[model samples]
Target: MPALPRARLLVAATAAAVGLGLATPAHAAPETIVREEARTAEVVAEAMALAEQLAERQQTLAVLNRRADARDRALIGYRAVLSRYGYDGDPDTARAVLPLASYDLSAGFGLTGPLWEAEHGGQDFSAYAGEPLVAVADGVVTEVADAGPYGLRTILTLSDGTEVWYCHQTDATVVVGQEVAIADVIGSVGSTGNSTGPHLHLEVRPAAGDPVDPMDWMRAQGLDP
Candidate 1:
């Protein structure tokens, strides 16, 4: 037998078996058969409605999954921005301020140790974790991200070409290319990089020169760290 004709014949046979043997008694009346056919049609219609409802639910779930994926990618991009530095535009004109509100000086610049490698490049302000770390000047944010030995840190380039490094931070509130005023909350004090305790490691580099004593530099700017 031909495949299409064979399959059609099988369908007709199964339909006959269902209508005669499964659905109707041998002596069923014509009116009873008409009522049974109407009931069967209603069942088929209900099944189609249920399938449409299921399809709608699946489509809604697909949309929600796409939204979740977008949110997750956005979060990842935000974190990546926090973990590194990049140059934005030219620096702006801004003066310097103390990096922290109030804190004891735990370490000063040029402190030497075998562990320190060369001289310590920055000043350490001993403050509790979560203490606010502010920008020292109004300038462009050149970097905001994780760094070696400094942990989480941010660097701002002053208008006069001075670079200020604020290290051992817990989080950065700004991104590269952001302009910040003096004392703007840039980050939180932390013990992230190579540190014995929670503190702010501050460095000053005038004209991108070698790291200078931040305390002396701050004093020249009339702000004590």
Candidate 2:
């Protein structure tokens, strides 16, 4: 039994000088003493908060692409085809302004329209039962069908000679020549043709055989429509 003590001989010569690899008191504390200008100012404030959240998501996608390009230029119409009313004399009078059709009738009218009140002689909610139909101007379709109570129809044809009937429709997408643009849906909202409930029996000729008087052309387009 020998003696050792002196703090266990200075703790075994500081663990044999940290097993000969030398540096010890927990490697004397120096991991680059946390500097480099405070880690480059916290990496430039996290790259300026990720460039201000990518400039507020590029200004909310440029205001939702300018409101979907102003509702696709209000369903394809601005000017061209100004109210004719011809019965096929073929004069080529040039005019095609579109965007008229759009009635809520507070929410009445659908199928072939005119519900009681002496057949819409009172003009209640006037139009719409299922409402999707949209192709006011750049058209071509020509005519699609449905039968069974006119449950669907199309008949586009616009280039100035007008004629854009699109009644009832529960689904028609488009067919004939198939050009379509303004409101482009071309079919939806249905009570099907001769309906009693759902609605959208639009009709407007103004030329190539006139029918003119869709609520005085939807109040000449300023639209209470």
Candidate 3:
């Protein structure tokens, strides 16, 4: 009989260790290992099915990312083109896959427009009063801490590599790794840290930790400061 392929031989041996009794290579008949190959094939097939399932999930994520990019463009009014990799231009406005609601999102509270504001890569915003706050997007609560002028803050990281930080909060809504939704309350606005008054301080950060102008993003969603 032809010799067994080295790859198949290794797989059969491992399968035997996991289930069937393993035999020494000194066994007389090559048929002994060939029988084990069929069992190993079943394992490989199961792995393929699992991979297919993961691929489908990736496709869903791609759609969501596309929508996010469109939302960004609308808010900032920038004609910046985006790759179709993660956009899903869903037109439904009923509820956001992740959304933000009224919770004292006031204006005049940053560097550019407000009396006091924070800086990110040379960008600024208006400063204003801080108060009760909540989640702006659906995601896991990744951070809850203080940033001198920003006050108590909570960061919610969405599945699509977008991070939302609710700053100038009086208190935090959730701890690290906690799952939160767009409709759920997370915290309140306050001047606990480095803030001046009681207004919500919001920032949108990339997964790599770069902060962008959330003003442009919020406007894209048709929200006013």
| Root-mean-square deviation of candidate 3 | 20.8
Residues 1-225, candidate 1: write the lDDT tens digits. 001123322443345446544455557799998887676555545554554454345335434543553465477662332221111222242345567655888888899987587899988889866666666767899998777677777899999999999886756778999998765667667665566677888989999899999889877865544
Q: Stretches of candidate 3 above 4 Å error? A: 1-131, 222-225
Compose the digit string of candidate 3's lDDT tens values, residues 65-177.
43554476577531121111112343333122222322433453234534544333212232222222345546898788765555566778877777887765545547889
User: TM-scores of all models?
Assistant: 0.57, 0.23, 0.46
Worst 10 residues of 3 by lDDT: 78-87
Best by TM-score: 1
Provide the clashing-pair count of each candidate structure: 4, 18, 46
Better of 2 and 3 by TM-score: 3
Worst 10 residues of 1 by lDDT: 81-90
Q: Which one wins by lDDT: 2 or 3?
A: 3
Candidate 2 Cα errors over 4 Å, as ranges: 1-135, 147-152, 155-165, 168-175, 178-192, 196-224
Candidate 1, pairs of clashing residues: 83-145, 83-146, 84-145, 151-193
